[model samples]
Target: MALTNSQYETIMREYEDRQTASRHLLEERTAEVYARVEGYRGLCESVASLSVSQGRKFLDGDEKALEDLHASLSSLSAQKKYLLRQAGYPDDYLTPVYNCPKCRDTGYVDGSKCHCFKQAIIDLLYEQSGIREQLESENWSTLSYDYYQGDDLQRFQNAVKECKNFIKTFDSDYHNLFFYGTVGTGKSFLSGCIARELIESGHSVIYFSAAGLFETLSRNMFDYKNKDDIVSFHEDLYGCDLLIIDDLGTEYTSNVAVSVFFSLLNQRHLNKKSTIISTNLSLEDLRNRYSDRVFSRITNQYTICKFTGTDIRMLKKRLQNRK
Candidate 1:
């Protein structure tokens, strides 16, 4: 979710482009109106003059200036509408249009990030989350108990219950989830279910495979020349509402990776932001790969759902081939 300066600039440049497009459109409409609508130019000029005069007169303590300006504007508006209709155009054709009416496509409203801007970020993250397509078919509503049995079924049901609770209370409190088990034991699928539900309800979510996460961290730590890129990447990792690190212990690990991972994990815990991590590594494997502190932190603070079952992906593929 952390953007390089160029990536950040790309989004800002889009906002600028939207404004420019809107302005050019208004200019074209104004020129068209002036050319086709007789007396429209004069009406616009009169309104402009009235606006300036009204502001100046009000500043000079003319108490009736605003009232007089309103009456004049209303009269001018009627004439303008009549002129546009005579020219076969709408009355408000010259009114400015914007991509985001709330922010005028400036990406900020009331000096905070606008809903449109936040949605833009969410869209970007959706593309990067890696589970976007899977979510469509893997959500809770599409889940089937037929795929599980015995101990696996019991564990799966329990995990679903816990995830539902997580979703229900997500706004009231903050918590993290750690999913560890055999490969294809429904870890990432359940994670995707949680992600889809929260995102549909308007929470910011960023997902990274362990490999992608470490690659980004390494790129920021050693490959980037600007320190701000490194800082911004860390800021993004810490700032999102939910961060999912999937397939842990599958990445190329080094000193830098371990350091960044531990730091990121610790900071998120301190900030009380929810995180969901799924890994094929067992508890003992995790302790051996990462430090005991990292293992201890997760075990102590996160709700653990241990998964055990046959590989569901292989089974599904085999079934598909049969069909």
Candidate 2:
């Protein structure tokens, strides 16, 4: 969830690129209008000069000059409006032009967020996530209780109930959850269900594997072209409405990677951002792999949900092989 400094730069650079593209396109259109309005410009200038001269005469007590000035102004206004119509531009378009008329391309309007900024964030998410193919697999409607079966049906049912309750009560202040259990125990299914609901409710969510997070962080740490700084990475992690990190302990446990992981987790805790971390590693293994600091933080900050069940992947593979 933490975006590296290079990633932040990419976001900004994307915004700049979009802005430049829009400006170039608008300039082309404006130039065409200007080319066709040369005659209109000349007429406008002549009318204004005459109006000024007539106004001087009226100031010198000439009543006839005042009448002439008013007539010239009326003629110029009508001609300008007519010319604009002929050019197929709105009458007010010529008054004050804007690339984004709604927000004037400032990314904000009247002290409120602008549609342009919102669009930029969405575009960046789409570009970076690459989750289009997997998104449909996680919808709430696709989840079925029949998928999780065992002597522990009661426990599975309890998890389902808790999940539904969590969705119903979800708000900005809800505590993040860590689903710790064996694989094939429906942790991923429940996490996906939460993702679908949160996304539908208009909250930003990013779901990535723990290994993926480590890989991204490691790459950003060493890559020179990537502009995202450590701070920016931390900011993105905390800024998201919901972050679901799956397979928590699969990453290479280098000293640096472990440190970075704890930093990300700790910051998310402080910010109170909702995170769902699904890990197959037991609590004892977590303590052994990382330090006591991590264990303490996890205990203090997250709601731990223990999952236990048979290996669903092996069962699916066997079934497929049989067929």
Candidate 3:
């Protein structure tokens, strides 16, 4: 939710590198064209020299000088483009380029952080959340259904349709997802898919396993010395656009963990922030383990997804061994 000073520096350095690279590329392109296009350099110099003189004359109340400057500059620009094409170069070969043209790689627009900068902050946060690399292979780009068949395939397809709908309407509607089923039934993979899609769309997403989620909560609840880290950590968990808890119910059972979990659900629901939880626990087991209040919050606020399919991982392993 908040970028640390170090992250800000890192993004600035990357922008600096982009600017340097763009400048170097432009210089090289300019030099290459100048060497091949006869009179191109002189034309460029003439345009610059005319701009200064004409600008001064215009300041001195010479309207004719302004008109002449405009015509002369337009003619020179056309000639420059013709010469570049004759020399087999693009007309805009010498134009400045940027990885992000909106801010010209400056990471800011009109003194505000650009969209690219915000996305960069989210990306770094994703890395720190410990799911960046995993998402690369689990997202939409890598979606596959080879391990599914029969009713399982139909169930998976239906569940996927709902997931897609959830993502599609995510901006206009505040909805949470609860994926509950057997282990290795693509529950976690689906969670990653949603996280990846939202993250790429420039929404902030934080992914944590149930154990890690509770562990961080436990630390924040008890660790008074590291007030800064605790505050930031909790803010990220509560304020992120999406928070994913994978393998829920695997965490150590304790009153503190339950209390923390209950509070997290309430705070996120109150804020209208979305949360996704995937667990192997059945509905009855969830109610028994986490208490009725916690279960009630989830059932009321989350769209329950029941995953029923062959264990994709084990199916893949078996298929591999057969091969």
Candidate 4:
């Protein structure tokens, strides 16, 4: 869920517009109040003069003058409040109205991104990845045990329990999950279930097909034109709360892809970020395709879940045909 330059620019522009609009609104409200209230303008002028006089007195080491100016300013504030009350206006009618009080329309609080900014990123991610639509149909709420039979059913039940437990106790210490088996065996479905739950719980989740993942990295590695985009893409990959890579073995395994994959796995593991990978390749195949180092990391760091049985998609299709 990396934001492109355009998206970043759009968000910044919106923040600027919000600040401008709030200032304009405060000015307009103040102008209207000043025009209707006779002493309101004079009261504002007196308050400004008092502030300047207090600063000068403080610099000149005149403690008595500073104290007198403070009292005068307080009296002027009370008079302004009284005037506004008589004019049927609230005490803070001229205050700037911020959409997000935590950020004060700045999109950052104490130098970190505010909740509103994170929400904006999430919204942009949904638009780019279409994960919102997938989650609606594939989440745990929509999961059906009826899709599995006998041993497959038992495995599915265990996986569902494990997935739930993972979500329940999820933190930076949580282990990564490796869902591996034949095609259409619900590996991707189960990963989606975990992703949907974590995302709904306000955790950031990024999903990518293996091909898409590799393509992004490979393109960024070779294309020097969009260097900033490459940084943003990698930042999201390493920084998201959860990363899901579906159909891991389907990617074209170029040297660059393998190198990037290893770096991704190693960085996330060291950072204690959780990842869920669904692959049709077997453990033996994984070792053969990826290097021993990559295979070792997956084996050592991930909770391997093996899916087996007939293809659930085919079975569902058959049932539909019979009906």
All candidates: TM-score: 0.80, 0.67, 0.70, 0.69
Residues 159-251 of candidate 2 have per-residue lDDT tens digits of 777778777877835687777878788788788788766655546677788888889888877767646455565566667767888898888
Question: So what's the TM-score on candidate 4?
Answer: 0.69
Best by lDDT: 3
**Model 1 lDDT tens row, 220-281:** 76765788766766766887778999999989997767878888888998888899999999
Work out how many backbone clashes candidate 3 has. 0
Clash pairs for candidate 3: none
**Candidate 4 residue pairs in clash (backbone atoms < 3 Å):** none
* Better candidate by TM-score, 1 or 4: 1
Q: Per-residue lDDT of 97-126 in model 3, one digit per residue for the tens?
A: 988889999999999989999888877767
RMSD, every candidate, angstroms: 4.1, 5.6, 6.1, 5.4
C-alpha lDDT of all candidate models, in order: 0.85, 0.73, 0.86, 0.83
Ranking by lDDT: 3, 1, 4, 2
* Residue 292 error, candidate 4, Å: 5.1
**Model 1: CA > 4 A from native:** 1-20, 50-72, 100-131
What is the C-alpha local distance difference test score of candidate 4? 0.83
Q: C-alpha displacement of 19 in model 3, angstroms?
A: 10
